[model samples]
Target: MSMDDQVFKRQGFGTDVDLVPPFGLLLVDFVNGFADPGVFGGGNITSAIASSQPLLDYARRCGWPVAHSRIVFADDGADHNIFSRKVPGMLTLREDSHASAIVPELAPIAGELVVRKTVPSAFFGTTLAAWLTQRSVSTLLVAGCVTSGCVRASVVDAMSLGFTPLVVADCVGDRAIAPHDASLFDMQQKYAMVMDRQAALELCDQAAPGN
Candidate 1:
C-alpha cells in the first residue's frame, strides 16, 4: 500500500459503509454548460454523462426517487455567492438559459425532482432532503459532473444529512483528470462510498425493497 493509504488506514478512515435500502438517485449538474467542453466540460465528463443515462434508466425502473440539479442563477445575478464569485462564469447559468438546462439524455421526467441552486450542494438551500425523506431514502446513489466540485459537494452534504451516499464513480467526472481522480480517492476515504455504477447497482439489488 502507498504511504498515504497506510496513514489513512491507520487513522481509521475509509471504513466500509453499509448499503441500506430505499435508495434515491441524485444527478448533480449534468447540464448543457457542463456537458459542452467549451463551456465547463472536458476530460471524461462526456463519458460520465453517457454512463449516467443507463444508470438513470435503471433507477427509474427500480422506482427510486431521482433528483437532478442544475446551477441556475437569476437573470440579474440575484443569487450569486462565494461559488459564483470564485467562478464568475457561473453567473451565466441563468434560470432560463440553455446552458443551465439539464442535458437531454438524463432529463428528469414528470414527478422526478429538479433541483436548481446557485451553489454546489443540491441539498443546500434546497428541498432535496425533505423530498428524499418523504420517500424514505436511506442510501443515495450519486452521479454527476465536475467530480471535484458539485459532485463532491453534494456527496458531502448527503452524508451530512444522514443519507448513505454511494457515489457512482463512473457516473461522475471532472474537467481535469487529476482532480477527478484525487476527489474520488478522498471521497472514498473520508466522505462516501465510492464505487463504479455496476457495483453500486449490485449492492442495491441485493438489498432492494421487497427483496
Candidate 2:
C-alpha cells in the first residue's frame, strides 16, 4: 500500500464494504453533454461511458432494477437552483433539450426508472430512494459522469439514506482526471465500496441472489 494509504488505514478508515444481494444500478448524468468533450465531456469520460454498457447489460441479464438520472430543468428555467447558478449552462438542459438526453448507449429500457433532477443528488428531491426501496434494492451499483460532482453527490446520498453504494470506477468518468481519481479514492475511503468495472460486477455476480 502507499504511504498515504497506510496512514489512512492507521486512522481506522478505508474499510471494505461487502457487496451483498438485491443489487440495483444507478447511472447518473451520463447525458450527451457529458459525453461530448466540447460540451462538457473530456478526460476519460468517453471510456467511462463505453465501460458502463457492459455493466448495464449485466444488470439486465441478472434482472437487477436499473435507474438513470438526467439533469433536467424546466423549459422556462422555473426550477433554477444553486447548481444552475454556479453553472448557468445547466439551466439550458431543459425538458426537451438534446444536450440533457441520456446518451443512447446506456439508455434505460422499459421497467427502469428515469430520474430527473435539478440538482446534484439523484435521491435528493426525486423518488429514487423510494423507488429503489420499493424494488427491495439493498445495495446500489453506481456508474456515470463527472465523478467529483454528481457521482459523489449521489453516492453520499445513497449511503445516508440507508443503501450500500458500490461505485464502478472504470464506468464513472470526469472532465478532469485529478478530481475523478480523487473522488474514487475518497469514496473508497468513506462513503461507498469502489471497484473497477470488471471487479465490481464480478463480485455482484458471485454474491447475487440464488447464485
TM-score of each: 0.98, 0.97
lDDT for residue 82 in candidate 2, whole number 0-100: 93
lDDT assessment of candidate 2? 0.93
Model 2: CA > 4 A from native: none
Name the runs in model 1 displaced over 4 angstroms: none
- lDDT tens digits, residues 1-211, model 1? 9999999999999999798988999999999999998999899999999999989999999889999999989899877799999999999999889999999998889999998898889999999999999999999999998999999999999999999999999999999999999999999999899999899888888897577
- TM-score, prediction 1: 0.98
Clashes of 2: 0
What shift in Å separates residue 122 of candidate 1 from its native position after superposition? 0.6
lDDT of 2 at 109: 90
